[model samples]
Target: MDRTELFLAIIAYTLIVQTFGGKAEGAMLPLFVLLFALPIYVVVHLYRNPSLE
Candidate 1:
């Protein structure tokens, strides 16, 4: 996905996490880190893919 799509995914995931897991579980550092890093990984993956436009 592109950055905008990834960002929206993160937002939706946050909402889902908060709705189901509630406040305390939603603040877990690991989850937050993964959420933030997702876009970085996407960018890196695109850069590394020689075939992509």
Candidate 2:
């Protein structure tokens, strides 16, 4: 999938299931925030390090 689609799917899946495939459910909020922030963080990191591409 494209980057945006992949990111959205990750967020949707994370929000949809607190446990995520019955593996665990100890830290929902932190997992959600990390899931949601990952894309933004990637963009910001890319902006800061354009030459890495």
Candidate 3:
């Protein structure tokens, strides 16, 4: 498995989940946008690029 990606996914998932956990109480939208965008970009990249290896 991709360790770095796994680590980041877990971290991002935790952050996103936590932020939305309590009705998004005190959630930072700018930061959330950034974090939320990253995974989407990565997913798009992977799908578009295919397994180059």
Candidate 4:
């Protein structure tokens, strides 16, 4: 339920959906958004809260 765990869960879910759903083409946009957004969120969060890092 912590941030790291939540992040990992999101990654795992995305991979599972992409792999098992057999619709990579359709899922690409969402997958890409998740992949890109997560890192950006982390970076902005860290930048805003240096104490967290």
Candidate 5:
């Protein structure tokens, strides 16, 4: 259970809940954006600052 695995698990759970929870029409869109953007942001940030780990 590394950081990537945990991040993916969280994204999977969020997508499952959003798909099955029966919310409004466009409610999950922001969550979808966040889920997609977050990894990219993390990757870019890590690339710029490689001293994190």
Candidate 6:
């Protein structure tokens, strides 16, 4: 997929996960890592410089 399709796919995925993820205990790990921990880590890690991008 190209960038636009890939971006929309990710947005759809995140919307589903955020909307229904908390209804089940089994979803907690992925929900936490993907929605919380990973974004925070990425922002902090790239705050200085994201040259790798």
Top TM-score model: 5
Task: Give the poorly placed runs of model 4, Cα more than 4 Å off.
Answer: 1-24
For model 3, which pairs clash? none
Worst 10 residues of 3 by lDDT: 24-33
lDDT of 3: 0.69
> Between prediction 1 and prediction 5, which has the larger lDDT?
5
**What TM-score does structure 4 among the candidates reach?**
0.52
lDDT of 5 by residue, 7-51 (tens): 677667677877788874465565677679888999999999999
Better of 2 and 5 by lDDT: 5
Candidate 1: stretches off by over 4 Å: 23-53
Task: Between candidates 2 and 4, name the one with more favorable TM-score.
Answer: 4
TM-score of 3: 0.42
- Reference-based lDDT, residue 51, model 5: 91
* Candidate 4 lDDT: 0.76
lDDT of 5 at 40: 96
Per-residue lDDT of 48 in model 4: 89
**In angstroms, what RMSD does candidate 5 have relative to the true structure?**
4.4
TM-score on alpha carbons, each prediction: 0.43, 0.44, 0.42, 0.52, 0.54, 0.41
Model 5's alpha-carbon lDDT is 0.74
Candidate 6 lDDT tens digits, 2-29: 7457545655666677677776454345
* CA deviation > 4 Å runs, candidate 6: 23-53
Higher TM-score: candidate 1 or 3?
1
Writing each residue's lDDT as its tens digit, candidate 3 over 1-53 gives 58567656666766796766986544456456656987998899899998865
Q: Poorest 10 consecutive residues of model 4 by lDDT? A: 22-31
Counting only residues 3 or more apart in sequence or on different chains, how many pairs clash (N, Cα, C under 3 Å) in candidate 5?
0
Better of 2 and 6 by lDDT: 2
